[model samples]
Target: MDNSSSSNITSSPTELDLDNLRAIKVLGKGAMGTVFLAHHASTDPSALSPFALKVVDKSLSFAADADRRARWEISVLSRFRLHDPLHPFLPSLLGSSETADILCWAVPYCPGGDLNVLRHRQNDSVFSPAVIRFYLAEIILALEHLHGLGIVYRDLKPENILIQQSGHVTLTDFDLSRSLTPKKTVDPLPVCSDPETDFVPSRTFTRFVCPRKKKSVTNQKGLRKAKSARVSPVSRRNPGSFYERSNSFVGTEEYVSPEVVRGDGHEFSVDWWALGVLCYEMLYGKTPFRGKNRKDTFKRILMMQPEFMGKPNALTDLIGKLLEKDPTRRLGYRRGASEIKEHEFFRGLRWDLLTEVVRPPFLPSKDETELTEEVKKGGIDIREYFDKLKAPSSPLWSPSLDEQRHNVSLTEF
Candidate 1:
């Protein structure tokens, strides 16, 4: 064979360069992708370690805007690890590249797996109050980072929350997220010259007011120059409105914010809504608002009837504020995250002291390395591992109509 002019291909079949990396094993399979575990040989070879590399089929990028999505994901992940300065909690983006139609991005492997897995592995055992507070505090810190950068994390669930050995929680999956600047108000409402002539008493506001909280005033005159600075003066609704009524739905049915369910364009409040749902799940083993069908679930959300069974008063109060059907009355929006932190559940927590607090309440299984070793020695049985971590059965676990729509018929994928 003429070596230089040979038409022959390499003997190995597209094997990843295990020289700079090592022992690539499939972590999970998805519709269009698979994740792998490989050591970082590109860095200091002497360093003992490996990393998680998420690889996606390039053909999956055949859509018109696939490249744009890929680039956006890469951009977002690159900065994910450094979001929180004081108590930064995110996966470090090691490196990324493309070969053929495969897109590969690497991050530090989370040994403890995710919250979903933990919840399943330890069924019926609720996270300690300290752990819950720490995890939620980390979540809020992460949200503050993304929100500050104008990004909206539309998807918030246990599956997307990864727990590191250090007990820090990192939010993942940016597919449904987008940058949000306050939507510019359209056609400002005409300013009133004479209040008595132009003022029309708001019927909607009547039901929400507390007569005893204020004076015995029938028609509270002299409306302030700005009723609610947070709300747009030109929006169809007045300031301090709960949820803007509209008709559109975007988000997981169980976790979708009220405004989003109603089709009104959502704002930061949506994050708060999802956070409430997460908080509910944290305290209780399941979501507060759930139903046998999609329609039923929607009804429950509208009713905002989440049962507070066997819940601590502090925890119930937190959930109550979060699950408020009216967004305006929600916990965080009223007094900001401060109120949430101040709740009795988090009484002794010191935000400023987090930096000095070297360790977290939970840690990854110490046998993680042994598990990996077994995989290398024989073969990695990821399916069996995850099967053992399946979520517990609950009456609320029925697949909704929308869930059925996207449900995979077979488990092969």
Candidate 2:
């Protein structure tokens, strides 16, 4: 983490040799970053070729500290390189490096921007149930791989899943991802080891609880006890480093899992809970338990009440089981994915067959035939907009660690 070189990484693609890849355009922009659509520098367009490249903006941070934060992001993404070759659903890693203002990592480019963008543009905002299940199955396999390696993808929103031109799905954005292993080391290093203490209860919980609790309970002495009993502060330190928590709000409120919202310790089951939320959204065009505000949203999530309107009975049942407020009663029931797969919703799902199922219900339109017409029509040119984003003169733009550690918004995304 001390290597300053990584923090001030150069964004110049000169080192990356993009000669192998051609920039098509930008995908989308967010507070912290932008995405681009790049093709393999060497490819025969007429024949099958290498996948597209995903270039993430490392310039989202504001200063040296933001640069340091970018380094942490780099560390998180680097972990994916360790994925087992045999893993069915893990995305292929192409290459990674630090840029002055962006941390460039190349991976198989997914042509589809994200499920959210796709659905939002659709009139119905819903996908076929079979198609949704197909993607879920892949995600389950990916989640299993992440959990096996101690990583947790805290942000599981539809925006993070990309549908490829070939109709396969790939997970992206490790900025919010983390390891489940405590940072503490059994064998101490010369420096103090980061204990597993940096556990993020999950952004899923931020909008649900006030972190601090107080009540007016009175004792038999007819005297009120201290209005606020002392409770351990949720550790905000990233057990590994003295840096403050990186995200103010943990998970998107609409899709937060119960255990995360309640601040009860959570394990990998939280991811499953998010998957359930995603499935529900995919089928219904909205969250099953949305509220007008954070308070109401938390109430619904904590109460475990979701109105499954018009969803298939199988999906409905699966969502119900996964959304259980009590983690103990969650679908895995501590047995893990085995129970999930065994559920009636997944009765016909063949884990092995599902991975190789190449025909997805949805895919990106690849015929460039309409490209010129749209350009002349003054329609959105997402690709060029993204490519034109100025390389930041400073480190990426990240909220102060304090902003991330505290002041989590209860309503905003």
Candidate 3:
């Protein structure tokens, strides 16, 4: 129960000692690793300060990729700590621990769970325009900060957006992100006097704009092969140079941009495209272009348009512009987030006063926090718990069943 905060804003990240942690319950699991609700073992268990610990088991068969992604996520989180004035919506690396068999890191816990869970709690499983606007704005600012640091966040979905104690949102899961240099433009040349005529040419000469190379749909099918042979997902290319494209075929199927699906290479605008899909899902309770299978989904993303349920409005209009098939034509492509901030959908928003809003659309109750506390007191060792579960003889635990039982007696927030 050493309650000392491991988060230091002034220095590089240091590995945390695992002996001080106590696991409460499992939060979630993914291809990368498992997350646990944990707190300082020496601190009072009932104290309201807890953090989420993500642990990657190095003993697993797929440990190499998992370990690489874990380290990448840690690097991304470390960047936020180095900022002079930290961005409010990005997670800070609270601590990290590395052992021969495991790699663990901690971030402040978001008791309200992820946005997907929150949306399911609503009456119709959809958020209203007001709520969507509030959440979208915060996400935009977070992406803006990441883009400024030459990072492209490839994954953008409801499950990655977590709600903090104050009801503000913080984005999570940065392992899929890639660092890219912003596209650079050459300066126009000045006109000079002609050698014989001694006359200056007209100043209105137009510079020829080079068109971006297009990849055929047939060739795009081999994008994965092309990428694997050329560069790794976690590439160490010169990020400070003018190159701005990533050929890595990464990102969730439903939220992947048209450019990504076509293997045309992607830059920062891909996040804006995913933002549109997110906004649509928040309002409609489902993604617009999802299909029966991965191939079908990619086809729909490239060839189909988002169908509107009713008459179009400012919000829908914004979504339409952001989802433009051509990345160059996307709403935020040229000017970045400033173009999105000026959209009519966000008109009259007091961006500066967003954090000061006393009440948000929803807030987690005291009972939920208490439920988390009760689970932690069950006396299960965090590392040993996962190891035991993985044994052939151990009974498989169903988190869904536990969630169902917990929900039975709970009141709606």
Candidate 4:
């Protein structure tokens, strides 16, 4: 964030004393690394700019490509700093620091947490259509900017989308993102679902007619809402997990794109497919192509199509176009997000005014101005904490975030 500066200290990657930083609390802990809310030890902890510090233990045996992935993410964050007026929906690198035992970087802390946690707080674990549109619009712009820079965000799950204090969002965790040179543009292919008017060549899944199980509704005549899905953008892995065998695949299972699943090459279009899945999930409270397990899930993603309940609508139509199994014909494949922005569903949207919107659908109630008890008490010393961790006899007691909000599957390494 431009407002908060960790630049002076982190810009220079050198060993520091115990007096430089204070760890507020463990924001999250995973196999790859741990995230901490930290403020400068030099200032009044309560009235200073705090940042989320993602520390990757260089010594972890299971974190394959730990240094590379961490550096890639930092490099990507570094790239963000170069943009004149940074994209409102993307994160900025506060700064970065690395020592012999750990690699850590800083970014603005998102008080509202991730999208999945927000969705779970909703009445039925789903967003209203209006709220869905607002969030999806922001996410689209974020992806649009990333894709514009030739960086493909392979992982577009709710877990990576964070709501800012201003109620806008910033896409986080770029470790899975890859830079791809887009294919040369051709005359955009026109895909028609009707068999009589179909012009798509080498069709794999033109129209999936498989029946879907519908929920009992109070008003039986009501149509259901749209939901979302993705492919590619593989995540890193730890050793000896149940899904260690499928290291060949990438991206989260439920959101992965069809081309990625089939070993076909993918580019920017994969993110668009994931956007569709996100929309579907926000509207319907579930992903469109989920099955019993990883194998069955990939099968459904390949052979089946998402089904809609009640009547077809503009949102559903957009989702359908995005979910096209053929990557060549999927919406935004050739034209990028401009193609998606032009869909009937987003006909009148003002892209330029997105950041200006004051009241977003969701906002973080946690006041950053007021320091929490952990922060007030001058919490753990980061240097000492790492020093202890570097010891062979360091205690093992790190907990994962709430299981309900996190979808843990190492199927894609």
> How many backbone clashes are present in model 2?
32
User: Over the stretch 321-412, how does candidate 1's per-residue lDDT look in tens digits?
Assistant: 77777665566553345445544555434454343344565567566565456445643333332233244652222332223222111121
**lDDT of candidate 4 over 3-80, digit per residue (tens):** 112123334333333357778877887555878888777754573677788888787774546566677777788778
Model 2, 1-413: lDDT tens digits are 23234322233222444434444444544433444445443453322343434444543334444445445455554555554453545555555554444455555667676777787776687877666777787787778667656666677878778776766677766555555554432221121112333322322211211232232234312311221221113222121121122223356677776666765555566677888889889888888778777778878888857786663587788988888776555665344565576555554344554544445566678866544343334432333333454545533333422122122233344
Please give the CA lDDT of all the candidate structures.
Answer: 0.55, 0.55, 0.73, 0.69
TM-score of each: 0.67, 0.65, 0.78, 0.77
Q: Is candidate 1 or candidate 2 better by TM-score?
A: 1
Q: What is the full ranking by TM-score, best candidate first?
A: 3, 4, 1, 2
| Candidate 1 ranges beyond 4 A from true positions | 1-23, 30-32, 41-47, 60-69, 80-87, 183-232, 235-250, 334-336, 368-413
Relative to the true structure, candidate 2 reaches a TM of 0.65
Best-first order by lDDT:
3, 4, 2, 1
**Highest-scoring model, lDDT:** 3
Query: What lDDT score goes with residue 401 in model 1?
Result: 24
Residues 1-413, model 3: lDDT tens digits = 01013223234376566876777777887767788887776664653577898999898887887787777787778878889777888998887888788889999899888898999999899998878988998899899889878789988888889998888899998877878755564122222111232222221112111122332566435633543453333333432123468877777778888887777778888899999999999999999998887778879999999999889898999999999997766777655686787666775455555666556777766565555656556545767876886787776444431122111000111
